[model samples]
Target chain A: MALSASTLKVGDTYEEQVVEDLKRTQLVQYAGASGDYNPVHTDEVFVTKVAGYPTVFAHGMLSMGMTGKMLTNYVGDGRLTQYGVRFTRQVWPGDSLTAKATVKAIRQEEGGHIVDLDVSTVNQDGVEVVSGYASARVDP
Target chain B: MMLEIDPKAKQGVQLGPVTVTAEDIQSFAEAMGDLNPLYTDVEAARAAGYPDVIAPPMFCMRMRGGRMLPEVPLPSGFMSLNAGQEIEFHDEIIAGQTYTITSRVADVYEKTGRSGPMEIIVRESTFTDAEGRTIVTIRERQIVRSPEKKI
Candidate 1:
């Protein structure tokens, strides 16, 4: 069900563990699905030797995708109008992530009511990995 | 400058008119670990008033075809990292429909942070369907960082 704007209010929050112990294989899967075969995300040897990173890391878009699951679940299917994020830090394998969305506003638009949300995803250590905003249509 | 880019980097490159498929939608949602039926089950999607299964909101990011960043030459020991992204969705990407993507280098600039000087390249990509209606627009930021810079 879509969130009802009648009861929605600013400062209301929802959170979910988007991923736990993020895996390299999942990165490979994302590469195949997204057609973003950047070696830095899936090739450990290249990322460590050539890219000079500790090991393969998750794609920023992957984190955004997972975080998006949380958003869609909160608002409802096909309700999002806009979703944007800044990749704050590198997400490494084995890092669990928790995504949270806090209601910023509930207002009326030309078509109907909408909810504005402040989105944030943080690693297990509480280091934020993705920060951004999303807007979605809501039920009146 | 930490890096050098081709003065005439290609922009507004038309990427694809690939048809969206149920397999593509399913794989993408699986990779992201989202089992939402609206993206996987056509019957469920139809119940929701969609013609077919719909791609997740961020699925438009995949339309880039591994061309998310400008093909600039990084200086020795410099690496590129994703800095941020902004996406606006005009409509849901429905399965069985063909879509084309056009990407352009919107801007390039330099900024110095606590670590050191870095260059940020902003790329904007638009996804449109067969009807020539816009589906989504994304602005992505990629940061070129020098080797000495520590995160």
Candidate 2:
């Protein structure tokens, strides 16, 4: 089935809840999978003693991954055409992250509907840790 | 130690002949605890008008193990940190499609911060579908910090 781009509109908003413990485990798993054993992510003691952080921090990619999840869920599969982001701050293990996406604009090109989106992940204190935009094609 | 690199010095490099499947997309969605029907339910996806179950936007980020960073000519004792990324999508991905990635070292530069001097390197990856259609282009920047600083 092809998605109709006409159904999506500007001002559409999507939100997701992020659990802290799940974030911690995901961070550890990412470390193991990516071989990024940075102490700031996996070692609380090292983070405290060496880096002076309050606790173990989540990997920046992990946060970005969470944002990607938000977009896929909102737009539906196969519709996502492009995604990117910038890491703004560190996410600690216990921090609650919220992912949000808002429709910014819609354009038609090459026989397809293109939707531009503003996406972001904000921590519990409301600081955006990751920010970027995504574009996708849908049936119109 | 002061390190010098030409910000304009860069070359294209290839990363994958990876096969993307619905299972991989599902796993990634599940791993992230996202239940968006667009990523899971085929009926919903169809109703939404996608040709098939599509992957998450950042799905390519998980395509690992094809290349080793150390194999590239990078400075020693410096840890790499993902700084930013920009991606442009060209086509929708279907399950069971094979892809070949061509990547290149795009640039290298230096920036001084309160912590010290940081080296920033950019890598660009182009994903081509099995039929040779270009699917996406990803530009990623990574910061390599001198190991002398513990942080």
The top-ranked prediction according to TM-score is: 1
Provide TM-scores for the models.
0.93, 0.78
Q: Show where candidate 2 strays beyond 4 Å.
A: A1-12, A20-23, A32-40, A45-52, B1-9, B21-27, B35-54, B64-77, B92-95, B112-116, B147-151
The ten-residue window of minimal lDDT in model 2 chain B covers: B64-73
lDDT of 2 by residue, A1-140 (tens): 44356777788888886555456677776665444566678887866775566787776666887787777667765667778898888787667888898889889988778888998889888999899888877767
Clashes of each: 0, 14
Badly placed stretches (over 4 Å) of model 1 are B2-11, B73-77, B148-151
lDDT of 2 at A130: 91
Docking class of 1: medium
For every model in order, the TM-score on chain A comes to 0.98, 0.87
Worst 10 residues of 2 chain A by lDDT: A30-39
| Tens digit of per-residue lDDT, candidate 1, span A43-110 | 88887877677998898899999999999999988789999998888899999999999999999999
Task: Go through the candidates in order and give each one's C-alpha lDDT.
Answer: 0.87, 0.71
Interface RMSD of each: 1.3, 3.3
Model 1's DockQ? 0.75
